[model samples]
Target: MANTWNGSDDPVTRIHRQCRWSTSTLQMTDLESDTTSECTNRWIHIRHLPSQFNIDLLANCSEYPLFDDFCPYLPNHGLGQKTHNRSHSWYRTDSHMLELIFHRRMLEYPCLTSDPDAADAIYLPYYAGIDSIRYLYGPDVNSSFEHGLDLFQFLRHYDSSHIWGKHNGHDHFVVMARPAWDFSQPLSNDPPIWGTSFLELPEFYNLTALTLESRAWPWQEQAIPYPTSFHPPNMALLDSWVSRVRRSRRTTLMLFAGGGGVSASPNIRRSIRLECENSTSTSIGNSGYSKLCDFVDCSNGICEHDPIRFMRPMLQSSFCLQPPGDTPTRRSTFDGIVAGCIPVFFEDQAAKSQYGWHLPEEQYGEFSVFIQKEDVVFKGVRILDVLTSIPRARVRRMRESVLELIPRVMYRKHGSSLGLRNKNDAFDIAIEGTLQRIKSRLAEISVR
Candidate 1:
């Protein structure tokens, strides 16, 4: 202080001193730590930037890098002609598929994973199944990478565990570089004790690859609807409903919602032949007709919601024949109940699993006939006998109940009674609701 100039001193000298001091301080700050210059040309460093923006810029600048990093492309894969805004085959649009878009992106943003045991998140195969074709396109094994050239982001595709292994480098995501299901290998590639995706634990919070199911098993694990386990469309009348569709037109028609079409046995295969439409009889194959109301592969599969063209005849028919696909307890069986047409369960082990929550077994037993698969026969039984015997009054009520079911699955006009299918949306409303509940539960638990 004794050596410093007083207030009357020269402004030039003071200004120079201040400038030098400020410049030294700025240089010190610049040299304090690393910057983007230090990470130049590193892809991993680049990827980390979006997540590693400094605290000062994080509040707003952070989201931009991630949004920019995501796939900047649109899919043009012609799924099918658009109908109901869906791929005409499935229930939604190409944008909803997101399969192609997700696949191409992983190539550019491959997650680095050195260990397969790291638990970070689930690699769900979006929909579910092990189709054979994608295997040729990509590798079908664990302990190996498919050269990772195929474009399927589904955790179920090439990876065997469905337990997406996280890149040890990032705490936020399970960097999955491979599909979880490969057909070329044995089924035991992933054993449950170890490989089962245990995401409910502390791992699955932030994710880089994700898809969600629109519906799920109602949580009371012990609470399965007998003959089926379904949450009726939310729009359905909450009151107990029991009804059957009244058959119109004197003409005979039989619709098979999910017949033994794809995995059809020689006998069940032969049975569709005996059934007739408008006095016209034809075999399931070569007759140029299909027996499926809808042939569903997983939404994860190549065919989404593509109703088997053969199923169209069933829709037009007075009676729809529904049996479970590979498994019995399914959404389709309920669809039939709600459709009001009689169902022939072709009773199997699956029928036993469900307590038969909605089937009118106690009252309208005659409406739904359950014949043993083995007895389906050689009996050469014709469907006409069942329809002729059922009372018209009972049929009308079934139809009423069926119509009631559709609106529950369909979206509504917000404040109106009229309903509609879920227009294309990736942010599944139901999934979001579940996540919100989970988050709330976590918050509540944390407080405790």
Candidate 2:
């Protein structure tokens, strides 16, 4: 039987005092307090961009053409099979979900205020990403440009008192799932390229842009992670998944799941495939539609379509390869993290340069591996050899770190489908980061 102390100053009391010190929740530091305030206290004024720009785009999602770029390395098109698909809503397009999830999360945010006067930051929730994709695949070549032109005209006519009067919209921000390159045209006075000319507008330069990938320009575009499949309903589900990932045995040293047909110029996928095939210890799963090659130790060459298929290998592998696809950023980075798989990247911009708020600052090597693009494609460095060299203890530490990030990286489901509860997820982090940035920008402007 456990011994009971006779007095308040007995051994039991001392043990309780020690346990309190060890297990009690730590008080929020100054940094954490500021972060929480930026997320919940800062009033954000969301602009009413045309329904055609955001709402209508999703309403007509069924008509969206099959985009090979959306899935990237993954070959299968549909979200999950309807018969076996979970209760949650799913989509085939990979990059488009960021806008949808952001919209929902923002609407549900307690700090979202319609009154522009009370706002510290202005949110121009434009559905530019999906609209860009529509025009890219649509019959009309100039449809995207016209869409941007129309949006510009609307904002131009909007009461300047509502936005422009407040430091000329310096606090205004827009979240686009596409990279900045899509909207930003080259300075050669070139014809409209992939995206709209919205960013080119003078007023747009003042507003900040939260995008999947930021450009090299000196403007205010911030890089954010592309949406992944795992949107856990609550923190409990997320914790459970993290525990599972931590408990799972990692047999494969490294895993690369992607398609080969996406890029033609400096076909990194082909090089990766060759290296993975040549290396005996590595596991390679072809994520493309064409079942041309048999996947090493996988059921089929294609597992991109199945969310479970995509996540299983990642969860079971010690390292997940995340090479650039379509753009410098890949959704697989987020997917790998949720599965507690260490991401091995060929490009620095994908996650290292991007996701400064969501990911740890100045510590890319802690949770991820960076192999230079030239080294992988040109120098012929074997991924397996590079990964296997990492000490087992270090690998365990990195995996644990990544498992901690799962909650922060995820988009917690909101509303009746998932119930109403406040949980800090990717959206919270992005909002807080943007608000803090706006505050800093305002300070800089004042100082200048």
Which model scores highest in TM-score? 2
Model 1 regions more than 4 Å off: 1-81, 84-137, 141-250, 257-266, 275-312, 324-341, 348-369, 378-382, 410-448
Q: Candidate 1, which ten residues in sequence have the lowest lDDT sum?
A: 45-54
Q: Which stretches of candidate 2 lie over 4 Å from their true place?
A: 1-41, 62-93, 143-147, 159-161, 187-191, 261-267, 281-305, 416-423
TM-score of 2: 0.77
lDDT of 2 at 154: 68
For all candidates in order, the CA lDDT equals: 0.31, 0.64
| Error of model 2, residue 343, in angstroms | 0.8
Q: How many clashes in each structure?
A: 29, 2
